[model samples]
Each structure stands twice: as structure tokens, then as C-alpha cells.
Target: MKLLTLRLTQNMHARSSLLALALCVGATSGEGALGIFEDHADIGATRRAGSAEYHAATQAYTVSGGGENMWFTNDAFHFVWKRVSGDVTLAADISFPTAGGNAHRKACLLIRQSLEPESAYADAVVHGDGLTSLQYRETRNARTYEIQSGVSGPKRLRIEKRGKYVSMSIAAEGEPLH
Candidate 1:
């Protein structure tokens, strides 16, 4: 199956589009939502907003800590929404430009976000170790579930939540996870 890969250049507009695509399709995240990046935690850098750089050719994003840099924290980034309802699904094409030093950078679907923008729920992340998994954060404690996945170009990450059950699925293309 051909991956739904999007080459992300250093285009702010493209990044914004990618952000929208990552958030709009799914229902609002609920507390105990169980996803990834439950808040506005920075993926690569904690101090610089939008510090990560995107490469169009490889469709990957890169970031380094500088000025208050820290490992990926839920407080530094999050998908903000006024309210979330119904079933939710997100498809992302992500890549990592570099990795190391507790970078823990990732691209995935964030959900159950509060309107505040500083808090929400997240799932589906491609870690710095080139591993993909699902995780959630509550009061500085993050719980991650290691799942077998190939982290590379044009990777597709998905999340679905219905009632009290939430599930994560990843694929390049060829039939959505059921």
C-alpha cells in the first residue's frame, strides 16, 4: 500500500495544515481519554514554540534542545479544542530528522484535549528510538504501551475512540484498521 506521505518543508502554512489534519478528524478527547501528548508539551524542544523543523523531501521533523530544552513533556505541547464529541480518527505522515539525548520527539494524534490548550490526551507516537507506541499523561506521569511498528517516511498513524474504549493503529495505506 502506498503511504499517504506529505513532504513538509519549512513552510509554516504546511505545518499548520498538518496540525489541522492531525486534530480535526477526531472527536474531542475526554479525560482518561488515553492517547498521546495530553497537553501542549513540546515534542523536541520545550522552550521554543514551533522549534521543530520539517523537511519536505523526507516528510520528517527535527528539533534540538536549547534555551530551556527538555525531553518531550506534556506541558509543553497539546492539541487544544473547545469541546470534543463523537468518534475521532487522525492520519499523520511523520518522519524524524534526528534522534538522541532524551529527545523523545514524536509525531502522533493527540486527543481528549481541553479548551485550555495546555491540557488534553494523546496517543500514537513515533519515539526517538524509532519505535511507535501509545501513551497518556496524568499529572506528570506518562504511561506508554510499546507496540510493534515500522517508523519511517510517510508513516500513517491513527486513533479511534468510542464510548470508553480507545484504540491506536498505524499503517502506510491499504485499508484502514477495523
Candidate 2:
């Protein structure tokens, strides 16, 4: 899956609110029509809110939003998801439209229990500052932690989950998965 191009500017507060409104009304309805992701899910109830839009021609999704953080005991970002059990693999090409957003801003491939803000989950994330890591919450409302990767600013990322194990991989633009 190819995800959104976050274009964060100086007006973060206004943009966040607008993103939420747009996601609530436009994300699901129009997004699926353009075949971005199979479905959408909300988790953690974000403070600033976010949205997702799909561009059919490019086969990419443009997602935007703001949150205090996706750490500690809870998270606050928009999620695009589909239900599955057992083992699964997710891959995506991600990028930002501009270079001026929050350094901690992220695009991720996430797997979680439910829509609860503090639900147990694991994800492979690429941060705005080019840090890539595997972040997870062991249990509901648990403190969030991460195991950082050596790679940074990868253009593609992948996450795989099998039973209790989760793994992440990254690659540069136009390169093979590592």
C-alpha cells in the first residue's frame, strides 16, 4: 500500500481540525471508491484529529492529522486498517509532501487489538526526521516503547506479524526490501 503525503505547514492547529472534519466525512466514502485501503479504523481518539484521501491515478493515499503523541499509554492518529487473524504482512511506500512537519510525525503499518486508544498493538513507523522503528504496546494502556532500526529515511517499509512475533524491515527508494 502507498500512503499519504503529509504536507504540514505553520498553521498546524487549523490544519488539524480541518483534517479531522475531512476524514470523518470524506475518508471512508470516497477513499474506498478510489481503492486506497480496504477499510478505515479509528483508535485512541486523537486530540488534534486527522484524515485520509485516495488518489486513484497514482494509487496512493494522502493522510493528514496531528496528535500529542503516539506513545506512553495511548495514541492519537488516524488509521487505515482491515481485519485479519493469524499471520499477516503489510508493505507500503511512504513520503511527506513537505519537510516542515513535526519531527515525530509518522506514517505506519499498524496492527492492534481494537479501536481503544490504549489497545495492545505493534507497528512499523517512519518518522518525519527519518527514524524508522518498531513500536508496540505489550498490553492495553501499557507504556509504549520501541526498538530503533539502523536504517533511516527509507522510502519503503514492511511489517510482518506471526502469532506473538512481529518484525519490521525498511529499504531506500527504488531499492529491494532489506
Q: Evaluated with lDDT, which candidate comes out highest?
A: 2
Tell me the whole-model lDDT of each prediction, alpha carbons only: 0.42, 0.64
- List where candidate 1 sits over 4 angstroms from the true fold: 1-22, 26-45, 51-74, 78-83, 98-103, 115-120, 138-154, 172-178
**In model 1, which range of ten residues has the least summed lDDT?**
12-21
lDDT of 2 at 151: 86
The C-alpha TM-scores of every prediction are 0.51, 0.79
Could you give candidate 1's per-residue lDDT for residues 43-145 as a string of tens digits? 3223334433334455343432222211234333322222346666655565443334233444555554543323335566655455666655432434333
- Positional deviation of 74 in candidate 1, in angstroms? 4.9
Candidate 2 TM-score versus the reference: 0.79
Candidate that would win on TM-score: 2
lDDT of 2 by residue, 1-178 (tens): 3333333222267323112111111123344652535555445565555566666767666666655456889777667655567776766677777775667667777777776778888888877788889989999989998999998888887777777898888888777777
